[model samples]
Target chain A: MNIIVCIKQVPNTTQVRINPETNTLIREGVESVINPFDTYAIEEGVRIKDKTGGKVTVVTMGPPQAEDALREAISLGCDEAILVSDRKFAGSDTWATSYTLSQTIRKIKDYDIIICGKQASDGDTAQVGPGISAHLDIPQVTYVRKIEEISAGHAKVERLTEEGYEIIESKLPLVITVVKEINEPRMPSLKGKMRAKNAQVLKWNADDIECNVNDIGLNGSPTRVIKIFTPPPRKGGEILKGDTHEVVAKAADLLKNVIIG
Target chain B: MVDYLLTEEQKMIKELCHKIALEKIKPVAAEYDEKEEFPWPIVKILADSDVCGVYIPEQYGGMGAGIMGMAIATEELSWGCGGIALAFAATGLGTFPILLFGNDEQKKKYLPVIASGKKLAAFALTEAEAGSDAGSIKTTAKKDGDYYILNGTKQWITNGGEADIYSVVAITDKTKGARGATAFIVEKGTKGLEFGKKEKKLGIRASATREVIFTDCRVHKDNILSREGMGFIVAMKTFDSSRPGVAAQAVGIAQRALDEATAYAHQRKQFGQAISSFQGIQFMLADMATQVESARALVYSAARMIDAGSKDIAKVSAMCKLLASDTAMKVTTDAVQIFGGYGYMREYPVEKLMRDAKITQIYEGTNQIQRSVIAMNLIKELAKNK
Candidate 1:
C-alpha cells in the first residue's frame, strides 16, 4: 500500500504579530514550520506503514523555502517527499491549494491512501482534505482518531465526533484527514534523520502536475483573501470581591440583577 | 552503574532538549559570539525547565539522572548551542565532585539549589601552569586555623564570572605533587575571590568562560573534597566520568553537520544534476556518514563501559573524546566545503556549525591529552587483563 500525507508549511505562530493600525498579520521575519497539527498526520502514516508493509510519501505545496518542512517530515519517517512549488502557484487559496494537491496526488497515480491534517493553523479552514477528496471523487475519512484496521484493499477507521467516535470502512484509494488527538508523533531517530538528509525531494509545479491553468493557483481560487485582518480585542469580564459568605451573597445579587434585568 | 539505554520517558527528554536547543540556543549564538557575552536567557531557560542538575540526587531535589541519561540530554542540547550547554554542564562538572564525594552536609547545603538552577556553579581545575598536566598546578591553599587561604588562578573556568558556587582546586603541599592538590567549594563574590574578563572564543559564545583569581580567598576547612591530598585524583577521576559527556557533545555537533551537509547536497547543484547524485560528493558523504557512526559507537561504548563497572572507562572515554571531537571537526569542515561559498558566510547555518566544531577539539582535555590518557590507561589495563 502507498500512503501520501499532505503537510503544510505555515509561518511559525510564535513569531507572528498582528498590525495594530491595519489589523493585519505581520508575515515578515516569521519563520516557517510544519503546521503543528500536520505532524500527527505524518506520524499516523508512518505508524500505519510500520504495522503493514508499505511506503509513506509526503507532499506539500508552497514556496521553495518550504522544502525544509518536507525534509522534516522525511526525518519523521516519511519514506518519500515532493515539493509542489511554483511561482505560478503563489497566492493560492484553500480551493486552489486543494486543487493543486489533488493534481499532484493524481500524478502519483498509484497511491492507495492519502492523509492530511484536519486543518492548517494558518488557514484553520479544515477544508483542503475534503476538497481534495471531492476533487478526486474518492470517499474520505475526516477527523480520523484511530486506524481500526487495513487489509488487502480497504481501511477500517474510527472517526471522532462531539459525543463519541464512529468506526467506518472505506474502499481503497481513500483520503484520511486526521485530528491532533489521534496519535502522538514519533521522535526523529538517528537513522530517520540520515534518510531525511539524503531523500530526494521531487519538485513539481502546476505544469508538471498537469493542473489546468484556470482550475488551480490564484486564478482558480474562488475565495480571494482580499484583505487579512485581525479580530477585535476582547472586553474585560466583571469583577467580584470579598469573603466567601459576602462574596456568595454579592454574586447571588449580581446574578439576580443580570438575569432579572 | 546501570543500563544507560533510554526508557520511554527519556525519549521525551530528548525531544524537549532538542526543541530547547533549536529554539533558544541558535538565535542568540551569534550575538553572544560577537559581544563575548553570557546568555543569561539560556540559564533562565534551563533553570525554569529544571534540567540543570540532571545528575543531582532526587532526595536533594534533583532529577538524579544516570550518566547515560545526562549524556543523551547533553548531546542533544549541545548541538544547538555548545556554549550554552557548556554553561549548564558546569553545574554537573563543578559539583559532581561534591555530589560524588561531598559529605552529607555538603549535599544538603549545595545540591538542591544547583540542580534547581537557582544557583549556578563553576568547576575550577585548569590553572595557568597546569592544564593537561594538572599535577603542576601552583595554586596554594594554606591552612589557617579554622579556614584555608586559597591563593591561585584557575584558567578557562566555565561560568567563572556568573556562577554563585565554585568548586576550586589548589595545592596544599608542594612536595607531594598530585597528592598535594586539594579541592574546595568557594561561593562566588567571596571577600578574596575575583573573576577576570571573559575569554573571546571562536564558538559556544552563548556560554561564557573566564579566569577566576583567588587572593587569600578563605573557605572553612570543611570545603575540601574527598580529602585534602586527593584533589588531583578527584579532578582527574571527574574527567573520567565527564569526558564521555564532551564526547556526547561532539556527537551532537557531528549530527548537525551531517544534517546540514546532507540537506545542502541534495538542493545544491553541480554540472547538470544534483550534487548528491555525483560519485565524488557521494564518497565524501560516505566518509562523513562513517565517521559519525564510528564516533557514535566509540562514544556509546565508553558510556556502556562506564555503566558496566569497567575500570577500562578512562581509556575508552579518552578514545571516545578523541574520535568524536576529530569527527566533529572533519564533518563540520566538510559541511562548509559542501556549502562551497555559502558555507563561508555567516548567514548560512553550516558556517556557524563549522565555527562551533573547532572548540570541541581544544576543550575537555584537548584531543592530544585524550591520546595520552588512552595510551597510559591502555598500557595499565592490558598488562593486568592480558
Candidate 2:
C-alpha cells in the first residue's frame, strides 16, 4: 500500500502579528512550523505504512522555504518528499492550491491513499482537503477521527460529526482529511534526522507538473479579500438586577423574545 | 560583525529537542525530583526518540552530528531538568572513550548498541580515593591470560547499576602512576560486579548515583580500549570532549532560571506596579539574559572547536565549563532573589533551578578543577612562546 500525505508550513499563529498599515501578516521575525493539523495526517500515513510494509511519501505546496515542512515529515519516517513551489504559485487560494496538489499527485501516478489535515491553522477555511478530493474525483472522508481497517482495495474509517461519528467505507485511491483525535504524532527519530538532512526534496514548478498558467497562482484564485479587520470586542451581557423570581421571569421573557423574533 | 548561524540539520535538531524539553521533560521533572527516582519513563522517551544517538557516528547507526549536536540537544534537555539531562548526557560521557580511543574491533563491538539507544552506557573513573586525581584510583585490572580481573569500588557512577555497558578505568601497573591506568569495557552482568548503596543528592536528584563494586570481575582482554597504560589519556580525552556538554547543560539551566524570573517579574507586583517596572529588577533581568547568552556562546564555540578537530581544546573546554557552570550558579541564585519569598518555596521552579545549577559546577570536574586546567594550559602555552 502506497500512501501520500500532504502538509503545509504556516506561521506559528501565537507569534504572528498583523501589520495595521499594510493589512498583512508581519512575518519578519515569526517562526514557521508544520501546520499542527497536518501532523496528525502525516502520523496516520506513517502508521499505515509501518503496519502494511509500504512507502509513505509526503507532499506540500508552498514557498521554497516550505521545504522545511517536508523535511520535518521525513524526520517522522516518511519515505520521500516533494515540494511544489514556484513564483507563479504565489497568492493561490484553496481552489488553485488543491488543483496544484492534485497535479503533483497525478505526476507521481501510483498511490493508494492521499491524506491531509482537516484545516490549516493560519486560515481555518477547512476547504483545501475537500477541494483536492474534488480535483481528483475520488471518494473522500473528511474529519476522520479513526481508521478502523485498510486492505487491498478498501478502507473503513470513522468520520466525526457534531452528533458523534459515522463509519464509512471507501475504495482505494481515496482521500482523507484527519482530525487531531486520529493519532498522536511521533517525535523525529535520530536516524530519520540524518536521512532527512541528506534527503533531496523533489521540487516541482507549475509547468513541471504540466499545469496551465490560467489555473495557477493569483490569476487562478477565484476568491479575493476586500479588506481584513479584527472583529469588534464583544460587550458584556446585561445582567438582571432583581429578586430571583423576578430575574427568572425577565430572563425567560428575553429568551422567548429571541427565539420568537 | 558577529553572526550566529546553524546548519539546516542543526536547526531541525534544535527545534525537535526544544519541543521535547517543553512537552515531555518539563512536566515530569518536579515529580521525579520529589520522588528521587530514576526517571526511567523519561529515559524510555529519550531512547525511543533516538536522542541519545545524536553524538554517535552514522556508521554505527546514529545521526553523527557530533559534539555540536550533542551540546545543542543537551542544552534543551537541561532546560527541563538538569538531573535528567545529565542522565541522558552521561551516555555520551561513557561512550566517548570508545569513540576516541577504541580500535576498530572495540568500536564495532561497543558502538552499535549505544548508537541504537537500546541500552545506556556509563563511565566509571571517580572513586572515594580519586575524584580529580584519576591517577590515584585504587581499582586494579590484572592481566591473567586472555582476561583481566577488575577489583575496586567506583563511587558516584552516573547511570550506575541501570546502565548496560561500562567504560571503567583501572590501574594496570601502579608503579607507572597515572600512566598505569587502563580503560576497559565491563558489561553490567559480569560476575563479581555489583552496585552498592545509591547516594542521596541535593540536586539533580532525579538521576541515580551509586557505587560500582568490582571484585574479581573478569573482563576479556579484547575489551581493552586503545592499549595498556593509556587509561589516563583516554579519561582526559573523554573529559575534553564531554565538558562542553556539561557546559551546555549549565547554559540551559541558566536560561530556564532567566525565563522563570522574567515571566514572574512581569506579573508580580510590589508597591503599586509590576516589579518589572523597577530599574533594579530590570537590571537583574538584563544581567541574567547577558550571562545566559555569553554562556551559550562559549559552550557553542568550544563544541565547534571540538568538531573542527582543534588540537588545543583543553583551555577552551575548561573555560567553557567553568564560565557556563559559574554563570548558571549566579543566574539561578539571582532568579531566586528576584522571586524573593516565592522562590524559596519548593512549589516554585526557581528554587529547583538554583539547586540544579550547583551540580554543574561540581561534576564533570569541579569549576576549581576547570580553572586549574585552564591555568595549567595557559602557563604551558606561555612557556612555548619563549
Candidate 3:
C-alpha cells in the first residue's frame, strides 16, 4: 500500500499576533510550523503504512518555504516528502488547488490512499479534502476518529458525527480527512531525524506534473480576494436586573423589540 | 516564566536542542520507558548533536554554552525524553567538577573528548546512608604510594553502569566528616572499579542507574577536585547550579500535562456539553494552566539570575527547584484527576505523566532539602539585609 498525506504550513497560532497596519494575516517575521491538526493526518497515514507494509509520503502545496513542513513530516518518520510548488498556483482557490493536486496525483504511478487534516488553521474552509476527492472521483471520509482496519482492497474507519460515530469503509485509493482524535503523533526518532536531515524532497510544478498552465495557479483560479477583514467585535450581552416579575416584564419587552426588529 | 534571554548562539542551541528532542528523543521516550532500556542510542545521538560537555569554554572544544543555555536545552530535551536527556546531561554534571577545579592537563585531557561527545561521564556522591546529608559520605579513598584506593559503594548513580568516566567523592579522612570528603575522577575499567544491578525506578527508568562499587579501586592522586575539604562545597555548588535544570524539567512536565488536559477537556464530553464547557472542570483546567505558567516564571527567573552572574546561586536555585517540583506534582495529579478513570489507566498518557512527575520532587536533593536550602539561604540574605 502507498499512502500520501497532505500537510500545510501555517503561522504559529500561539505566537501569531494581528498586524494592525494591513489587517492581513501576518506571514513575515512570524514563525511558521506544520499545522497542528495536519500532524495527525501524517500520523494516520504512517500508522496505516506501519500496520500493513507500505510507503508513506507527505505532500504540501505552498511557497518554497513550505518545504520545511515537509521536512518536519519526514523527521516524523514519513518515508518520502514532496513539494507541489509553483508560482502560478499562488492565490488559487481551494477548488483549483485541489484540481491541480488531482492532476498531480494522476501522474504519480501508484498510491492507495490520500489523507489530510480536516481543515487548515489559516483558511479553515475544509473544502480541499472533499474537493480533491470530487476531482479524483474516489470515496472520501472526513473527521476520522479512528482507523478500524486496512486491507489489500479496502480500508475501514470510524468517522466522528454529531450524534456519535459512523463506521465507514472505502475502496483503495480513497481520500480521508482526520481530526486530532485519531492519535497523538509520534515524535521523530534520532535515526529518523538523521534520515530527514539528508533526505531529498521531490519538487513538482505545473510543467513537471504536465497540467495545463492556464488552469493552474492564479491564472487558473476562479476566485479573487477583494478584501479580507476581521468581523466586527462582539458587544456584551444586555443585562436584565430587577425583581423576578420586573425582570420577566423587561425580558418580554426585549423579546417584543427583537421580534419587531 | 523568566526569559531564556536566549542569545543568538543560545537560540541556535535551542533550535538544535529542539531538533534532537523532537526528532531523536520523542519517539524513543516511550520505548525506553516501556522497556526500561538504557538510552545509549539517545545519549549517543545527543553526543553527536548539540550536547556533550556543553558548558565548558570553547577553548576546551566546547560550544562555550552557558548554564542558562544548558538549562533551556535540558528542559526541552527532557520534555521530549526525560530519561534520555538526564543521561546525556549527566556528562555535564560529572565533567563540571573537573572544569571547575582540574589542572590544565586534566582540562586538556577530559574536556575535548567530552566536548566532542566521545566520552560519557557520571557524578558519584550519594550513598545508601548519605543522600540528603551528603556530608556524611563513607566512601573512602585510602592513599597508597602514588595511587588512591577507593573502597565503598556509591548508590543511586546516574549512568553509573555505562559512563566512561566518573567524578567520585570519597572520605579521605574519616575524622573530618564533610570536610574529609575528597573528589576524584575514576575512569571506566580502572582496577577494582565495578557496577551493581540496575535499579528499578518509577520514573527516568530509561536512564541507567546502578551502584558504582569501588573495592580497592585505584586512580592517580591528580584526579582530586579542588582540594581536600572542598568536595562538600563543590557538590553543593553543583546542586545550586543544576537545580534550575531540574526545575525546568518540572516546568516541561507541567506544560505537557496542561496541554494534554486542555486538549482532552475540549474533546471528552460529560453530561450534555464538553467537559471544558462545564464551570467546575474549566476552573480546574484554568488553575492548572495558571500554575504551569507561574512555575515556568519562577524557574526562568532563577535561570536568568545565574545567567546574569548573580553572586549567590543558592537562594534562587533552591526557590526555583522547590516551587517548580511542587507545582509539577500538583499539576500532574490534577491532570490525572481531570482525565478521570482514563487518567489512572495505562492506556491514557496522563497516568504515565503522573508516574513521571512524582520523581521531580524526589531526585535532585528532594524538595524537602530544597526547602531547607531555601530557608537557610534566605536567612543568610536577611542577615546581610541592608
| Candidate 2 Cα errors over 4 Å, as ranges | A18-29, A63-65, A85-97, A189-200, A203-261, B1-12, B40-50, B173-176, B308-311, B375-386
DockQ of each: 0.02, 0.46, 0.04
Model 2: residue A187 alpha-carbon error in angstroms: 3.1
Task: State in Å the error of residue B206, model 1.
Answer: 2.1
Clashing pairs for predicted structure model 1, backbone only? none
Docking outcome class, model 2: acceptable
Report the alpha-carbon TM-score of model 2 versus the true structure.
0.87
Error of 3 at A135 (Å): 32
Q: Which lDDT tens digits does candidate 1 get at residues B56-152?
A: 7679876656566567778888878677787777667887788777899998999889877888887898987887787888889999998999887
Interface RMSD of 3: 6.7
Q: What is the iRMS for every candidate structure?
A: 10.2, 1.8, 6.7
lDDT of 1 at A57: 89
TM-score of chain A of 1: 0.88
Task: Return the DockQ of model 1.
Answer: 0.02
Kindly report the docking quality category of candidate 3.
incorrect
Ranking of candidates on lDDT, top first: 2, 1, 3
lDDT of 3 by residue, B171-241 (tens): 88888777888889899999899999999998877888899999988888888778877878778877777
